[model samples]
Target: MGLFSKDIKTMDDLFVHQLRDVYYAERQILASLPKMIDKATSPTLKQGLESHRLETETHVKRLEQVFEMHGAEAKAIKCPAINGILEEADDIVGDVDDKQVLDAAIVAAAQAVEHYEIARYGTLIAWAKELGRADCAAVLEQTLREEKAADDKLSAVALGEINRKAA
Candidate 1:
């Protein structure tokens, strides 16, 4: 359903809708990571992407658990925001010729994804608590910390080496 659809008549409904949104986003990130990993020329970047791919798997599972805990169906709705971000990443990565530059592009793309996720998870956590589901918030908080860490690692990789080599 669209964000403004009458189907979300209450805060709880809104929370569930956002939950599904992030669910779809996390799955998309999971699918896209392998390609990013392969495209990365830097060993540190590649290893970080791979490691986060594993974490992304756990993120999906945790989202499912949150769904069950919140008594909502464990399903995903189309998240256009994530789709657009991933598509833009692909476009940018494909346009770059230099492998080192491509690694930098990949890091930038991955950071975009991480930033998107961080926003979604942060909002979800707040909504969960507002809905009196601190349990769900707590679960989502774990993923938020991971997402933030992933973003930080991407920044470190970019500033420390990738951007320099690309330059």
Candidate 2:
């Protein structure tokens, strides 16, 4: 069911829906990251993306655990927001001819994804707590921390060298 659909009648329903949303988004990122890794001109950015891609795999498994704890099978709903972000990244990469500038663009695109994940996981943690699912909250909190770390790393790579090199 779509967001705000009749299928979502309680906070728990809302939480599950969002969880599914991010689940799908993470899967999409998994599919898209290899291309980003290949396109990246900076060693640091490529390495960071590779690491995050591995982490994303763990995240998907954790999400599956969460679903099992909640008495549901792991499933995904479409997340157009993430699709849009990934598409924008592809467009930016396609348009850029300079490797250095492309590296900067890749960093920016990655940060966009991290920011989206941060928002989703942060909210999921809060909702899990409100729903009295401390177990889920703790697990989601771990993912949230990882997302933040990933974002910070992207920022550092961007400001430390990529941006300057692009300029």
Candidate 3:
């Protein structure tokens, strides 16, 4: 459903729908990361991509458990924001000839994605707790923590060398 769609009947419904959105986004990230790894010129970027890919898989499994808890099918809603982000990253990376600059671009694109995820997961956790679904909140909390760590690592990569190269 589009943002601000009147079809959302309750806070619970909106929460679940957004959960599905990020669920889809995470799965897409899982698929796109390996390609990002391949495109990365820096060994550090490649390794980071690979590590996050594995983490993404675990994330998907956790989301599956959340779906079961919510008694909702673990199906994905189309998340255009994430799709656009991933597509843009691909387009930008494709156009770059400088490996260092490309790596920096990739890092920036990734941080954008991580920030989006952090926002979603943060809300999901709060909603879960507010709804008295502590189990769900805890489950989502794990993903939130990981998302934060990923963002921090990407920042370090950007500051350490990726930014240097891009300059």
Q: Scored by CA lDDT, what does every candidate get?
A: 0.96, 0.94, 0.90
Q: What does the lDDT read for residue 97 in candidate 2? A: 95
- Model 3's TM-score against the true structure: 0.95
Ranking by TM-score: 1, 2, 3
Can you give the TM-score per candidate against the true fold? 0.99, 0.98, 0.95
* The candidate that achieves the highest lDDT relative to the unseen native structure: 1
User: How would you encode candidate 1's per-residue C-alpha lDDT over 99-120 as one tens digit per residue?
Assistant: 9999999999999999999999
The stretch of ten residues in a row with the least summed lDDT in candidate 2 is 65-74
Candidate 1 weakest ten by summed lDDT: 33-42
Stretches of candidate 3 above 4 Å error? none
Query: Tens digit of lDDT per residue, candidate 2, span 1-167?
Result: 77879999999999999999999999999999999999998999999999999999999989999999987769999999999999999999899999999999999899999999999999999999999999999999999999999999999999999999999
Each model's Cα RMSD: 0.5, 0.6, 1.2
- How many residue pairs collide in each prediction? 0, 0, 0
In candidate 1, which residue pairs get closer than 3 Å at backbone N, Cα or C atoms, i.e. clash? none
